[model samples]
Target: MDFDNFKTLGEWDKWKGALAKAVDLGEAIGFNENTVDKMAYRIGNFLSSTVDPENREERVLQELWKVADESDKKVLAKLIVRMVEKDSRLH
Candidate 1:
């Protein structure tokens, strides 16, 4: 899928739902949490570099991505993964 399309998706909920579906698919495919989280970071890097932030939260993440060193970027990625997991549970 063209990850860049996410920028034009318009709504934050659409972005969140798409990400949740991806997470569900990864789990269904037997990818462990660690691998999924690693991939999430790579995806995050791609988005941060290629796509303009589509919302306030995404803009904040973009700002953080711009300033973060390599190690901290990994942390940010993990945090995002965890947030997605928590959100899925809540809804």
Candidate 2:
């Protein structure tokens, strides 16, 4: 996946759509939930460190990330994965 394209479409919905696609791809390629959750955690860490939030939701997430402990962050990552999974199902 070329995230350069996604960077251009910077809306929160676009971000969620990209996440949904990534989740689908991961599943299609036989990544288990734990693997995917770890991937999401890494991505979240990277984004929190390197990227400014593009929207209110993202800003909120960044703020939460700033305050969360490792275990909490993992739980947050899991919730995000579940959220996107449910979101993708709706579309």
- TM-score on alpha carbons, each prediction: 0.83, 0.87
Task: Report the lDDT of model 2 for residue 18.
Answer: 92
Candidate 2 clashing pairs, residues 3+ apart or interchain: none
| Residue 36 local lDDT, model 2 | 96
How well is each residue in 1-91 modelled by candidate 2, as lDDT tens digits?
A: 9886466556877889899999999999999999999999999999999999876789999999989999999999999999989989998
Clashes, model 1: 0
In model 1, what are the clashing residue pairs, if there are any?
Answer: none
Evaluate residue 65 in candidate 2 and report its C-alpha lDDT on the 0 to 100 scale. 93
TM-score of candidate 2 to 2 decimals: 0.87
